[model samples]
Target: MGHVILVTGGARSGKSSHAEARVAALPGERVYIATARPEDDEMRARIAHHIARRGPGWLTLEEPFDLAGALDRTDGRGPRLVDCLTLWLANLMFADRDWSPEADLLIAALARQNSPVVLVSNEVGMGIVPENALARAFRDAQGWLNQRVAAMANEVEFVVAGLPLRLK
Candidate 1:
């Protein structure tokens, strides 16, 4: 089985950078499974920045909902990095889909992976409770998703200010 690593932190905490480094350090070709959709200009710019930072040595797959399917398709190809699971959860919620089943599928897929998988996620529950119900729901779901992934992961790192603190 492939080694599973989860890197999570607050916004702009360098989780993606750390996850990228972890995947790059692994053997075989590198695959980056991006879940972000360029729905607006700001998001488009962020996606571009990420693409530029990653450079040219990785195969990129844009799968916003079917992450489990993406992992299955790319299994054994190389080390795979799933950047920002929080965005994926948002995508699912916005689409009116239940996130738990998808999360379950993701965990199962990770267990079956033959190449290493490094996942990047945001820690959304650290801040004060949001005033809006939707925001609160998203925060709660994100926390649950992160915990589920961390439990399945062989290694877990919490990044803050560009530094990674191993949690598992």
Candidate 2:
């Protein structure tokens, strides 16, 4: 029913910038679905920076969790950008929420959307395996989430050194 584009990359690899640019070129007011929760000073600064980076044309919706619920109610007439699914995953993990149900809801919502959606995520499985069990579990969950989203996307791109390599 809608177009979903998946953008994945390593940290600081320009995934968000590319996703933003892709959605900004489309018509209608951009709806930015921010999933980051500012817990500390650095994180707060990061959130502020992200807000400042976006123009006044964007209607920012801060949904650290309940992303599926937000998407279900959001107007699908405009191109929406969900900046970084990785943090959303982390939030779910830390909150002891069932990731599968939330992920399923997100996929369902995406399938019903009437406009384009650019999903940003980190390619975490590419790096060395984690030493801790929790970290390993998070990585595994992230991989699963990315795989699921990629399968639903009309286009999938891997960003490296600020360059996008189309994967689908």
Candidate 3:
């Protein structure tokens, strides 16, 4: 099994940067499994910014869904960085696709990986309760997903103010 690291934090907390560095430290070509979709101008700009920050030496794969399949395909190639799970979850939810089965598949794939994987996820449960039902539901689902991944991860880090605090 590969070394699985989960990097989580609030928005703008530098989770993606830290996760990228973790994957960059490993040997072989760096694979970036980007989950974000360029749905609008703002999102496209954000994606561009990430691409610019990463600079080069990355084989980027845009997989808004089927993350498990992406991992399986990239497994033996190199260290992969899944840049943010929150957007993946949102994509599933907004598209009316059942996310539990996909998440389960991801966990199974992670267990069988042969190369290192660094995953970025947002810590959304730290703030006050959301007002809308959909927002609350998303929060609950994100918390559950984070817990499950962290439990299976070999190492977990919570980033705050660009600092990664090891949790496991």
Candidate 4:
């Protein structure tokens, strides 16, 4: 059986950095599945920073909305680091696709894979509910996604101020 590790926290909480460090420690090639889209200059710069941090040795796969497809492509080789599931959820939500099915499929696939997976996500539920409908829906969907991933994950860690707290 494989190991599923979920690293979650709020914005700039170092969840992605923590996930990268954990995956880098593992043996074999590191596959980074980045979900963030470079919709603007700021986002592009953010993506570049993450890429630079991961260095040039890691293989990067940009799957903005097809996480299950990306997981299947991993082929159980090495540790797969999925940087931020929240963006994937947002992409799906924006596309008008209900994200539950995809989330379930991805979790099930992760559970059965032979390679270790380090999934990063945001802990958005700690904040007050959003007044806008879309934002609220996104928050709810993200919460559900986090719960599903956490349930299947062998280890769950929450990062705060660059510190990791294991929850499972």
Candidate 5:
């Protein structure tokens, strides 16, 4: 079985950078599964920044909602990095889709992976709850997803200010 590492942090907490550094140290073909969808100019610019930082060596796959499908497609690759589950969850919520099934699929898939897998997710429960229902739902889902991933992950790291603190 492959090693599963879960990295959690707030926005701009350097989770992606930490995950990339970890993947860079591992052997095999690097696969980066980016879940962010560039729907606006600012988002597009942020995506570009991350892409530029990743350079050309890693194979990039953009799958906003079908994370399990992306993982299945990357079979036999060296290490795989799922850049942010929080965004993936947002995509699902935005599309009015039930996220529980997809979250289960992701967890099961990660459990059976044979190569190194690093999953980056936002730690959304640290802030105050939103007044609206949608935001509250997203926050709850993110917290649940993080808990599930952390439970299955061999290592859990919380990134803060570009530094990683191992939590599990």
Candidate 6:
């Protein structure tokens, strides 16, 4: 079984950087599973910047959804980093897709992974509650997802102001 790491924090809180650093310290080839979909020019540029930051050393897997399927296909032969599950969650919500089954499948897949896996997510519940139902629903789903992953993770870290505080 593979070791699971969960890195979560507010936006721009250095969660991705901390998660990448953890993966970099681990042995084996790195596979970055990007879950962001560039729907606009700004988003496209942001994605480009992220890809450039990782450079040529790591293999990139552009998985906007179907995270469990992507994990299954990768075979978990090397260290894998799934950055920003929050975006994946948003994708699911916006598409009116059921996210629970996929989240469960991902948990099962993580338990069976043959190599180390690091997951990054955003902790969005610390702010004021959203006035809209859809936003509230998304917030609830995100919190649920994070809690589930954190429970199963071998290590969990919360990042704030570029500092990581280990929770498990």
lDDT of 6 by residue, 19-53 (tens): 98898898888889999998999889978978877
- Give all candidates' CA lDDT scores: 0.94, 0.89, 0.94, 0.89, 0.90, 0.89
lDDT of 4 by residue, 1-168 (tens): 678899999999988999999999999889999899999999999999898888887988999987877887895679899987998998888999989888888877886788888999998887777899999988888988898889878999999999999899
Which stretch of 10 consecutive residues in model 1 shows the poorest summed lDDT? 120-129
Model 2 quality (TM-score): 0.96
The true-versus-predicted C-alpha distance at residue 123 of model 3, in Å, is 0.8
How high is each candidate's TM-score? Answer: 0.98, 0.96, 0.98, 0.97, 0.97, 0.96
Residues 25-134, model 2: lDDT tens digits: 99987899999988899989988987787768998889988877777667565899998799999999999998989999999989988888899999888778889999
Backbone clashes in model 3: 0
Q: List the residue pairs that clash in candidate 2.
A: none
Which model, 2 or 5, shows the larger lDDT?
Answer: 5
* lDDT of model 6 at position 119: 98
lDDT of 3 by residue, 1-168 (tens): 999999999999988888988888899989999999998999999999999999989999999999999999998999999988999999999998888888999999999999999999998987889898989999999999999999999999999999999999
Error of 1 at 18 (Å): 0.8
What's model 5's TM-score?
0.97
After TM-score superposition, the amount by which residue 55's alpha carbon in candidate 3 deviates from its true location, in angstroms, is 0.8
Which lDDT tens digits does candidate 1 get at residues 1-168? 799999999999988988999998998999999999999999999999999999999999999999999999999889999987999999999999999999999999999999899999999887889999999999999999999999989999999999999999
- Give residue 128's error in model 6 in angstroms: 1.2
